[model samples]
Structure formats: C-alpha cells, structure tokens
Target: MKDTFTETVLEVRGLTTTISGKRGEFTAVENVDLTLKRGETLGLVGESGSGKSLTGLSLLRLVPKPAARIAAGSVVLDGIDLMSLTEDQMRQVRGRKISMILQDPQTSLNPSFTVGSQIAEALALHTDTPRKSLRDKAIEMLRRVRVAAPEHRVDAYPHQMSGGMRQRAVGAVAISCAPDVIIADEPTTSLDVTVQAQYIRLLQELQRESGMGIIFITHDFGIVAKVCHRLAVMYAGQIVETGPVAQIFDQPLHPYTRALLSSVPKLHGQIGRLPSIEGTPPPLWDRPRGCKFSPRCPLADHRCRNEEPPTVDSPAPDGSEHWARCWKPEAI
Candidate 1:
C-alpha cells in the first residue's frame, strides 16, 4: 500500500543557517520551510553543499558553534515551538523528542565507549529506566536493528564492529528513545548496495513500529523513490521545488528539479551514459542576484536573472501536493 500519512509532526518556516568568516557571512541554508507528517518520510535531495545537512542540523539546533548558526527560523514540533525553547529544554528534546542518524558511524561513535555503553547512555539520558535495566534495554535496541548476537556484540567497541554493524548500532541509539522524528542525513552513503538496502528496510520497519516522522536526506533519487512519501529538492541552499514523490517524479515543475530527476541512473534495460546536470553550483559567497539556479537553467530569462522567482503552488489532483519556484512553470 502507499503511504497513509495523516497528521503533521514537524513544521519549519523561514529556517536559515549561516556561517561567518573573514570574507563575510554566507548563508548555508536560506528561508527553508518544510513539513513532515506522522508515519511519513520526506526526502531532502540535492548535491553536496546544497544545505540539506545544515538544514537538518538547524532543526535540532546543532549547527556548529561560532562558525555556523541558525540565524532565523521557527521549528515547530507537534505544536511546540522548538526555536523558543531554552538550551536545557532543547537538550531534553534532542535525543528524546527528535533524534538524528548521522552520515557516518566511524567518526560519530566514540571509540573509547563500548557499543552497549553508548546505547545505554542514550536511554539513561532520556528515560527514567534504572541503571541496572539500561544494559538490557540497550541489548534490545540492538536487536531491534537486526544486529546479530546483540548480547555479546553490545560489549564490543565501535572499532570491533563492521561498518554495517556500526551503522546499525548508531540506528539503535538514534531510535532508542522512540523519538517523534528522525533526521537521517544520508545514513546509507557509505554502505554497499546490499547493506544499504537492508538499512533502508530496517529504518522503514522501525518507522512503521513507532509511526515516527522521518526526514531522509540524500541526493540519490533511487533512495527517494524507494522511501519518500514527499520530495523537497534543494539547490544552492534553497528549496526550488516540493511536492508528492509521485507527482514530482512524474512531472517536476522547476528546471533544476527536472534535471535532478532526469539524472537518476536507470537500471531496467540497456541505456547510454546517464545524464548529468551541467555546470557547478554557484559559490555561496558570489551567489548570483536572483534565483541561484538561474545560471544553469535552460528556460531562464532576463526576469529570472534579475528577480527571485515567485513560487507557484499548484495542488495535485489527488490533493497530495505541488509547488515550484520558477517564473515559467507553464514551460514545463
């Protein structure tokens, strides 16, 4: 069956994260707004440096200190304004209310701590479980992620596990508290194809069990196709288009969105080389005056260059979703 999403679990508005250096302030993510419903997955797709990862960090108020910060935005999680919370309150919300599965486990996991200790620590921090039962809970969490020999493996340090096992261990920790939402930042990036597929199914199973919302961040359209209920395509730090996954894949409105979908590698039958987007992304510091994608957009005109394109929100026939920031949606 298709997604049966109902209630909105997360709503973001005007979310911007910026970094400062001698050259001046550069916006890593600008005025980004997105919604994720309970029991639904939203795919955040774009090339590296498109601010996808930064946007995820900003939602959790984890943007690196001093160098980068969430300059402006409202992050509302289940009617509560996350942006308005105090540091202590936000800390409470981080692993308990909202969790994150980072891109890499080798760097994310502390080598000194045993896998069991790390997972138990997360449960201890969030729940009132007695210290004695924490170890059992940690083992159960590992089992939930389909880790083999959880009882014994939990005692091993991260370095002792395979890459896939470490990733699964990280997943165990991320979902340990049964968070309302999980921000998966390309969690499958480093895994081989087989392991990647397994991890994806593991995540889907966990989401089904908990009805948690997920923001799956990746540039792989195939992953988007496999998991996402909706799509949000970013380019050079801005979301150029967003809509239901089927609608956007079938009929992308923005040129950049179309290009991205077109570049997805086909697998069914024999085909020539895969298509790719032309030109590199605009440098953040020297970004063009108007639409950041205008320079490479084929349909771009004088208006597109000099003015920010207005968003055209055309609702789908199924009442699913549709929206595009382009001067010429009719052209598509």
Candidate 2:
C-alpha cells in the first residue's frame, strides 16, 4: 500500500501540560498545536527541556501522574478525543494503533523478559493469534527488523543484546502490531553513527511499508533533513516554525529555527564558529510575558517583548504550507 494516506490520523489542538511543583503550577507545554496526517513523517526538532518528549508522552497519555496533568486542550486521533478516553480505552489504543519508541531502548526494555517474550506479549495483547502462531510471529518480526539469527536472539534477554540490537528489538516489538502512528523519541540517541543510520533506514522502510504516521523527535537538524518530510521547530514549549524540510533548510522563518540550523557542523571548508543563540531558555515557571524567545531573538522589538506572535500562514516554494509564530518572521 502507498504510505501516503489522505486522512488525518492525529490532531493536537492547544495542548498544554501543567504540573504542580512544590513551588507552584507551571506549564511545561503551552498552547501547542500539531497534526499528523496518515503515513507522513513530522520531525519535531527542539533542544532539551523544550517539551518535545513531553508532547509525545501526552499523545499516548503516558505522562507521569501527580506531577503532570493535561491542564487544557484536546488530543484527537481518528476523530476520537484521546484526552476523554478512559485509562482502559487508552491502553487499548497504545501499543496497537498508536505506539511509541522511548528515547532509551536499553532502559525501556525489560531486563527480566526474553526479547521474544516481550515482543510476543505486545502481539498477544493486540492480536488473536494462538500461542504457537504468536511465537512464530514474534520471530518473524525480529527477522523483519534485520536482527541476525532471530531464532536464537529471540530467547536472549535485553541485557544479552548490544545497544543497537536492543533498539532494533524494541522497534520489532513496537511495529509488531503495525500501528497507524509511531512516535519515536530520539530513537537513535547515544548510538554510533553507523548504527543510527541503519536504525533510521529501518524505521523509514517499515514506515513506508506500513503507511504509519511518524512523529520523530530529535535535536539534530541534519537527522531531521534525512528522514522527515516536514519539520516543526520548537522553542520553549511551542512550535515556532513549521514547514517542509526543504523550505526549512533553505529558508527558515523563525529566528530560533535559523539559529538551530546555523549550529549544525559542516564537513568541509573553514568551519565557521557555530553561531549560538545567546541567553538560556527561560524556566517554565519564569516564562516571559510575550515571546519566550524574544530575549535571544535578534529581531525582537518592543512589540515582540510585549505581545505574543500569532501563527501566520506562509507557503513554501513547493506549495507546501509553512506557518511561523513570530512578530518579525524572516522575509521571503
């Protein structure tokens, strides 16, 4: 089947996450809106603590309790509001229709269960296959992920596998049920470059075959260029710029996005000193009154410091739409 689907699979509107700390209530994610069309890859690029991971977690309703809560907003998947679903109903959606591959595969995988058993458990929950068929299917999944000697590796525990192997194992389990959407949060973090490349290729191939909508979270703009069809640059807790990958690389709109792209290291020529965005991101509790990035933005004016920018529509050269939230967006 063609990967591209006309239907929209996921829609996040004005999604916000607030937590009550010992000090006071603070918003980790604020007024963030994103959408994922069926079978499309939306790369979410942001620095640490920018709430990219939190946003992904919120999509699955897996945010930690007590400390975290969806303060306000709606998460709709396939026309169903995920925020309104019961715990059991959400669980049914997770690992089956909507799955996630956490940042650290080594920590995410169970140390006690064999790789095969873990994958089988995920399959069993979502499928009606019998015991024997389930085991066979698990092995097939391992093979599909290109795990060498899948039959032998299936019985091996997570600790028995290498870092790359464990990640592949996680991928196998995540895709075993052929989810409609897969949110991979830094899936290649800390891995060797070669391994990261292979993992990314695996994911792309699988996504292409399964027609899965992907939300790939990463800090690397280069990685985003390689895999994502479209890109969303996040700063503080909101998407500042969103557009096609080519447009984002060629003509970035938001100042933060431009700064992020400028920071990527090149292989040749006199490597110019990477231009760093001055000033640190504000603490959630200490967010500015207007634009959160105004302190670091070179284009910031009085209005930028006093009023938040609205998302303005801008079309890319390829006819793909781009939107940026900035009072002084870069001119075309």
Candidate 3:
C-alpha cells in the first residue's frame, strides 16, 4: 500500500462546473486548482455563491445530477481520475478514500435509522469487516471523535442527539473507514460558538491521528485561521489568492483579498469603523468580461477590465512564496 502520509492524496486541476439554467449554461466553478497533501489542511474561503461548496462537492463527483456537471478539468485522487470513473468505480472511492461531511447534518443523516446503525452500514458497505465487529468499530470511531459514552450514544437516533452531536455523528460516518482525505463543508455552521471551537479542535486531532488530508470549506476567516495551514481565496468561481495563513492575512496582494482582510473587524486596531468591501459580488450568470472582480475592484484600470490577469508568484513577509491572480496586485 502507498504511504498516504507522504503522498499528494488529492489533486484537482482546472476544475469547472456548469449548470443548465432556463436561459443557458451558467458556470458555477471555473478553473479551480487545488492539491491536498496527506495529513495537511487546506482551507477554502469565499463569500456566498463564490463556488466554495460546489468545488468541494465536485471533488467527490457528488454534484447534483442533470442540471450540474463537471464541465471540465480533472479530479485526481490517489492517481485515479474521478471524472473518468464509472458510477460503480466511483462508489468504492467516495466514502472509503475521500469522504465528505456536508454543510447540514440534519438533512444529510437518515431520520429513520439510529446513528450507530447508519455508521455501521457505512463501514459494512466500504470495508470487509465482519458483522459482529462492526458495532465495536462504530463505537471506536465515535470515541475517537470525542463523543462521550459512545456505546450508549451509538443506539441514539439523529433527532435524539443535539445539533453538535449530530454533526459529530455525521463526521463519525465520514471518517469511519479512515479515509485518506476528508472534505468538511461548513461543518460548524449549525453549532454554537463553544461547540464550534470544540468540533474544529476535534477535527484537527482526528486529522493528526489518522494522517488524513483535510479540505476545509468555510466562509469565515476566523475558522480558516483556527484550522487551516494554507488558504485559498475564491472569487467569482476562481481562486484569486493562495498562500500560508499568516501571509494571506498579513500581506494580501490581490485587490479582492486585501478588501476581504480590510473588512475583518480587528480587536487591537483603532480604525473607527470596520472597512467594508464596496459593491456586491458579481452574479454567476452575468460574469464580468475580463477579470471577474474588476468591476468591483478599487485598483481596476482599463487593462484589468479588458484583459484577464495570470497568476504570478510573489514573496511573502516571512520569505515564503504565494501566488496572486491580478493585473495590479498591491505591494505589501
């Protein structure tokens, strides 16, 4: 078996997803490229409708049918191209190798079945463990996620558990088979502040123990700071900036990235009021002709409006390097 700890478990290159609308095909995600190393966390952050969640779903080939399609690009997980897989072939890889914890656990979990039964079923489907050993494995997985009294809670239904518990249970199922990569899509959205912190810490612990690469999808910069080693900022279906967490936060280059950081309310700073990014995000259907963010960007010039910029390597404050896609990235 390949040592997943040292390998690039997932590589997503030029991923683009499109949906058929009443008028015509609209691009949901465009030219997204991401790579997740084993046992590392890559935080994907963006505003609503910025294609963060859609990109996460596309990684597992789980985009909704008929309307949504992976229009272009390759999703390579462990050297296997997900786009090229048949339904049956993809099934074997989905939960066992690359699992996803969805945004809402209440809707994702089965209302009729007990949480333990659901988790056991996942294990049985993905692994060759005997029926007698499945419950123990389920309980073990639950305990690993820091669920107290796992044996008792295992028999409880989704409704019996609190929102945090339900989310943890959903996580239990996703990581039950010890997947090589876990795509957590807004896992903390339904939890309270304290519980959200605990859940994130638990995920970090689990990632450390299992050596699983994590792709954390969230809109909150606070959460990104807490869990992510590196960050990717998406805008209008494309990545505008990517760098280490410290670099991206301290010395942002892209206009959109700078605007986002400036908008964040800081505790120490005495800037009268928080800086807000001007204008709303561009609609996917009515995307701008050149740079997608050019219309709303403060530094936009004729070149920005007429020509798309290429992503260029840049130096960070700490001597590290990152890339920003802009015609005129700000000097830090």
Candidate 4:
C-alpha cells in the first residue's frame, strides 16, 4: 500500500456535472480543479447554486442519477481514480476510503435506526471487526468525536438526540472508517454559534489525529475563516480564485472574491447596514458567454463580456501562490 501520511490525498481536474431537464442540459460544474493534501483543509465556498455541493457529490459519485451526470472529470484519491470506479467499486470507496457528512443530519440519519447501530453498520461494512465488538468500536469512535456519554447515547434513536448531538453523531459515522478524505457539506448549518465553534474545533482535532484531508463545503465566510487552511472560491461552477486562507482574506484578487469578502459583516466596528452584491447569479442554463461574474462585477467591462479571462497567479508571502480567473484584477 502507498503511504498517505504525507501525500496529496485528493486531486480533481476538469470536473463537470450536467443537469438534464426540459430546459435542456445545464452545466452545474465546469472545468473545476483543486487539490487537497493529507492533514490539510480546503474550503469549497460559494453562494448557493455555485456548484459547491454538486462538486462534492460528483467526487462521491452520488449525484442524482438520470437527472444529473458526471460529464467529465478525473478524481484521483491517493493513486486511484474515483471517476473510473464501477458502482460496486465505488461502494467500497465511499465511507471507507472517502466519506461525506451532509448538511442536515436530520435527513441523512435514518429515523428508524439507533445511532450506534448505524455507525456500527458502517464500521462492519468497511472493516473486519467481529460482530460483538462492532458496538464497542462504534462507541469508541463516538468518544473520539467527544460525543457525551457515548455508552448511553449509543442506544438513542435519531429523534432522541438534540440538533447538536445529531450533528456530532453524523460526524462520528463519517469518521468511523478513518477515511483519508472527508467531504463535509455545510456540516454546521443547523448549529448555533457556540455549537458551531465546538464542532469546528472537533473537526480540527480529528484532522490532527488522523492526518486526513478535508474538503469543507459552505457559503459562510465566517466558517471558512475558522476551519479552512486554504480556500477555493467557486462562481458559475468554476473556481474563480484560490489561495492561502490569510491571503484570500487580506488580498482577494478576483472581483467576485473581493465582493464576497466585502459583504461579510464587519465585527471590529459599526457600519450603516452591510453592503450587498448586486444582481443575482445568472441562470446556469443561460450563463453569459465570457466571465460569468461580469454581470455583477462593478469593474466588468466589454473585455470581460467578450473574452474569458485566464487564471492569473498572485504569489503569497507564505510561499504559496494565489490564482484568480479575471482579465483585470488590479482594477478591483
């Protein structure tokens, strides 16, 4: 087996997802590219419909079949290509080599099953642990996530747990197999401020312990700041900008990236109403020919409308480079 401890855990290129409907096929994600290393966190951030969650689905081969399909992509985890796996092969990959924590635990967890059984089932499916020890293993995993009273909580059904407890349980299930990569899709959406902090810290602790790569998908910049080591900003199903977390916060290059950071409510001081980005995201089916963000960009001009901007490099102080898809980033 190859060593995953210090290797690039996940690499994706030319990833595109197509949605088929009466209105014709729409490209949900287009030529999106990113990389995640073991023990690192890469935030996949964008407004709703910007293809954040769809990219996660495409990675897991869990896109709603018939209506949507992975048109093209190369998803290499460690040395294996996930896109080329058969359904049976992919089944072994999901929740074993890679796992996902969805946005809502209420829906992801089965109402009928006890929390411990579901976790034990995932563990049994992936490992050679004996039947009697499955329950103990499940509870141990729960302890790793800092779940309270794991032994007692193990028998509780989904409805019996509070929102925060259910979210933690879902996380325990996701990490049960100790997969190399974890795709957490808005895992804290249902959580309040305090619980959200605890969850974020717990994830960090887990990553430190397991050296797993994390692809954290969310629209919240606040969460991005808390958990992400690096960030990939998506717009119109494409990564418009990416860089070290601090650099993106201080020197956002793409107009869309800048606008997004600007829209975050200022905590240091007061301002008369928060600023908002103008214009809705263009319909995916009828996206503009050139820069998809041009319609909402204040600096978008004829060139932005007529010609697609290539990715420009912006090196950071930390020796890592930043990239932005824009024609005139300095103008922003």
Please list the C-alpha lDDT of all candidates, in the order they appear.
Answer: 0.92, 0.88, 0.88, 0.90
33 Cα displacement, candidate 1 (Å): 0.7
Name the runs in model 1 displaced over 4 angstroms: 330-332
Q: How many backbone clashes does candidate 1 have?
A: 0
**TM-score of candidate 1 to 2 decimals:** 0.97
TM-score of each: 0.97, 0.96, 0.95, 0.96
**Tell me, what's the RMSD of every candidate?**
1.2, 1.8, 2.9, 2.9
Query: Which lDDT value does model 2 have at 202?
Result: 95
User: Candidate 3 has what TM-score?
Assistant: 0.95
lDDT of 3 by residue, 1-332 (tens): 11223478888899999988785999989999888888888899999999999999899888888889999999888888989999999999989999999888678899999889999998999999899999998999889888889999999989888888889999999999999899999999878999999999999989889989999999888898888887899999999998888878877889898888888777798869788888989988889888999989888989989888988788664554488898888864
Model 1 / residue 25 / CA error / Å: 0.8
lDDT of each residue in 171-253, candidate 4, tens digit only: 99999999999999999998888999999999999998999999999999988988888899999889999988888898899
> Which candidate do you rate higher for lDDT, 3 or 4?
4
Clashing pairs in 1: none
Q: Which digits, one per residue and each the tens of the lDDT, describe model 1 over residues 15-75?
A: 9999997779999899999999998999999999899999999999999888998889899
Superposed Cα deviation of residue 97, candidate 2 (Å): 0.8
